[model samples]
Target: MNRQVERIFSQIDYLSSAPQADRYGLTKLKALRSEMERHRHEKYGLSEVISWAFRIKHALASQDHSDDWREGISWIGDPDASSVDRTLSYEYMRSDQKLVAGSIWNNYYPWIRRNGWSTIGSVHNSGMGAIATWILAVREVTKDSSQIVLLTTRLYFETRQLLQRLLFGTNVQVIECESDCEFLERIKEPTNSKVVAYLDSAEQSDSLSLFQRISSAPLPKPVVLVGWDNTLIPYWKNPVDSHTKLSAPLFLMRSLHKLDQLGLEVASAGLLTAASPAQLTPERARYLELLLSEVKNSMKVIGSTASPTTIRRLEAFRLPNADLAQDSNQAATAASDRFHDSISGVLPKYMEAVSYPHKVFVTIPLPGTNQESISKVMDQIVKQCTLSGLPVMRSPSVGYEFTSISSFLSESDTGDATRFLRVSPGGHDTDMIDEISQCFLSTVSNL
Candidate 1:
């Protein structure tokens, strides 16, 4: 598998020079996908697959889409690789919509259906932006004053509160769930309530287990998982749609920024993916259609449609591994693990590091009982690293302390934090990560 990964990057350079570059690239990409599916159960192998996918993405992005597709619709080698850069307007955007919809249904959309992602919604790349608009769409479809909109992450509570009041205080009520139990409990008496959860923190590793519970239980409502974190690891099959129970409709609302395997940040990008036809029962299908319809209505009202450049970028950004493009640094596993071992894993008395998934960060307590304590530790680490002459984080995605890891009720969700100290080594290799880990350990142990 490691050889397969190395081979892709090695051969990737030759792709441009080869007689049939697209053919060569496509062949290798398909092979990589096959290997990914084979080793989907192993996390380490998944990391290799992502690195391979990242190389392919880099190669494709580097290639020049020299021809034009402005007047008429056409793509280079891959039909899904639709690329165009021009000023996009309402009419043009509508045309783009038709083109995108047609392409998805005609090409990869059906194929990706097995991967558990289909019915790509309008692209609204920002995390909060996509959530806000999707809420509006849900609002349009439901008049149930009793209908609950469960927001698992406290990060979105304020936004929902403002929208709740601003939109005439309709039947929809927003509830913030501190834990998965709270999320499930709040919606236990479900009429037509839905949930929107953001798996933004690496520390929150227990959400998938919770989803498994939700999938197995006789719950009626559906949950929409945003932020690219959920799909990073494969569970039963597809992280979102591969639920063995297949009880409720599962819709994935992803902030496209989280999709960058190389951890590249797109300033503006948003994608809301629909449920798989395989999992959608007639009742579930009806629910999905109504919500999707409202989502479109919300997007139309807000004028947050994606730009042509954005469309091009999004098309190029999507890798072929069934949207498993959640933000995971292949380096993060080793670096985060090393940081954890040196700090909380070995020494939990003076300092503690919250356990996280394969994400590229490790956090220590800022030393407060409130979730706020779990935040603002980045500043401390930055100061410590600067004082130690260590390199600052190379990754672009980071969070501020308005709400911290302590906000999560489940200790398993957030390892250990009165507050937290997040130290991430984005692309650093073994030697580099060892150095970075030592630097973090010294700074945190001293604190």
Candidate 2:
């Protein structure tokens, strides 16, 4: 069997074996399995759909844990109260409302037009979907089978894989750059083929600067910039615990407007909804409209001064760590100090930690410690927290596997890692922090 096909089947088997499979609806599972078998021979479309199905299943199964953990930390878990009914709420909304791809674009059109993009020609299922569509669109426009794609540093492993897979069987050249200087220098070279520059939050400012330079350059070939802003949403505030969000619509609007301003075409994607374009019905459109309205209202309540011209600045208001009336710099310093002190109270002696803007990453280094050992330690920590009714998440170390875009962009690498735990202080109080600290300490001491 093809390796990818085998992997897909393995994922289906894994989902089938999940203890909570029935909770996700056996009929849905059966239908997905049937579809998987029917499309086993398909190399492109089915492969992507199956891959996405694995993610959707995992997200659905993990909701209980995620909700409990988020609630313990005083963070918003399920904004829509989807978990109350034991149904995949997002999926239910998509299906029952008949939300499809076209409706998604239609609903987002107002936001897009307000942002200055007159029209978006196509829509895709996810951010990766948009990217794939964009790649093909570029190919069609340039009338060239070969092209060059420039990628910024710190791209996720899965994203890299998707790009490679999508670009396979073509002479497309992908170049990875570690710094702005390198990216700028490379694009300085002239060519008559399509050139796509992909940027993520890892280096947003730098990427934007490079993009501006590219837009202004007197090059012969068409230049387009694709931006991934999936992490821009306020997850800690309205954590509906759903995998999808308004990210696709937001990304589509932002990218299209920005690209149009530069006299270029753009393609973008986001993890906004699991439903495809074909699913958009009238009911689905209404549900999407309501969801987007709630999001905007929530932002307003949080004092987000975002407008169509400055939507990128939309973010949740973070409570100050310290009660100080000093200047901005002094207040910021005091807040950092207070946060570090709070984290120190919870971290185990076996672990050494560092704090970033939004979260803290703690590393536990034991003699001969490897990834497996670290994972065991993480499991123990999680178990203890669960027993004690605390909510915390196991996250990858900074500069390693899956750091947040802000952390990845702002922080420097201290060293490589076996495992690390990330703790966010958002929506958490001092007592809650101490309780979490005790949980970690207790687990480490017992070990």
Candidate 3:
């Protein structure tokens, strides 16, 4: 009778006792999650889907009734439309389309604002394009041909490297510091060039102090703070003490692919400027204006314009965005809590001490003196997870070497031969989480 199992049953029993409407909503949520999971693995990414949506939107708006246009395109139009204006619509749909996508924004900006993040800009792009747009905008506004970019997010070594090469070599130089201490030190470097720093997650215990330091520190150049998934769930705000207002321009990048549980996967990405629902300082206000123009312009330059279809769908969706993030957070909390509870006193047996670092995931560092042993344990965990039918993954945060989540520790300290695994139960059912918790607990206990 594990407490985790009892908790799962309680949740189920409560659901059974709840009003019919709540149950229906929960059912719809699960269906949406299932659909999202299915489509994410599709060959056609949201970007390409956006292209098709644009082409369709263009065709419907065009006055061209010529034979070439008619012969080239094969799409059925709305029956009531006149000959001159075609109303071609996407054929792919779920019977529950409106019920699912019609309300994704039910939570909307309020959820973000409630969580101490403000909406930065009025425009957006899709997927990773949102982040790229933010970076490009920062580079453009700074007007520094050779500028410094500080990355403090806990991402894979490969992901960090990709950022460095995103632009021309001389345009933007990315500095991947081993710790926030280095970031804090480097931010003070003498440079008139506009500096853009990326910070992520509450995983780092020092995030609040870092923010306070950034606020008081006299930065050489105007600095802008940016992050992805920060649109709703952020590594930007310190979980312990969320300070809504800041001295700098804050741009939260969003990709709803994973954020919005409603499966819109709108391939929609947005460059949010302010940590919204709050008043902006005169300085942050000016920087916000600078970025709006640059981010929108960069999207145009890269042919990464925001998808009109996705926008309409997101706006029209019935569910709240706040609900999506909240539910996802709840799931992560339950999973993480269960993991820690299961392994409570026995963690030291097989691994270094671990703790819940993020709302969406937890890191468990495998104890090892070399790469081979760390990798072997990782493989064992994966095998165990697979055999148990748990959807555990090798996350970017769990680097075998030279990688860390939120740089919680120095590279020299944990980067050599240690490897950690990131596990979370976001978007999972409560009962399934119970099973996952038990399975992983067993796997670790035996180790």
Per-model lDDT = 0.46, 0.36, 0.45
lDDT of 3 by residue, 299-344 (tens): 6666554443444433323233443344334544555566556555
Q: On a 0 to 100 scale, what is the lDDT of residue 6 in model 3?
A: 32
Model 3 misplacement above 4 A: 1-108, 111-127, 143-159, 171-173, 185-193, 201-209, 212-245, 262-271, 274-287, 303-319, 344-353, 365-420, 426-434, 441-447
- lDDT by residue (tens digit), candidate 1, 101-209: 4543123233246654455545664645566666676666566535545455433333534455545667655554565566556545544555444332234436555
Candidate with top lDDT is: 1
User: Model 3: number of clashes?
Assistant: 27
lDDT of 2 by residue, 34-79 (tens): 4545554322212233334434433433334343422211122222
Each model's Cα RMSD: 8.8, 18.9, 13.2
What is the C-alpha local distance difference test score of candidate 2? 0.36
Q: Sort every candidate by TM-score, greatest first.
A: 1, 3, 2
The segments of candidate 1 whose C-alpha lies over 4 angstroms from its true place after superposition are 1-96, 99-112, 115-118, 144-168, 185-205, 221-237, 240-243, 266-268, 276-284, 314-331, 345-351, 358-360, 367-391, 394-421, 442-447
Which runs of model 2 end up more than 4 angstroms from their true locations? Answer: 1-113, 119-143, 202-222, 233-374, 393-422, 437-447
After aligning candidate 3 to the native by TM-score, how far in Å is the CA of 191 from where it should be? Answer: 5.1
lDDT score, residue 148, model 3?
Answer: 51
Instruction: Highest TM-score: give the candidate number.
Output: 1
Candidate 1 accuracy as TM-score: 0.61
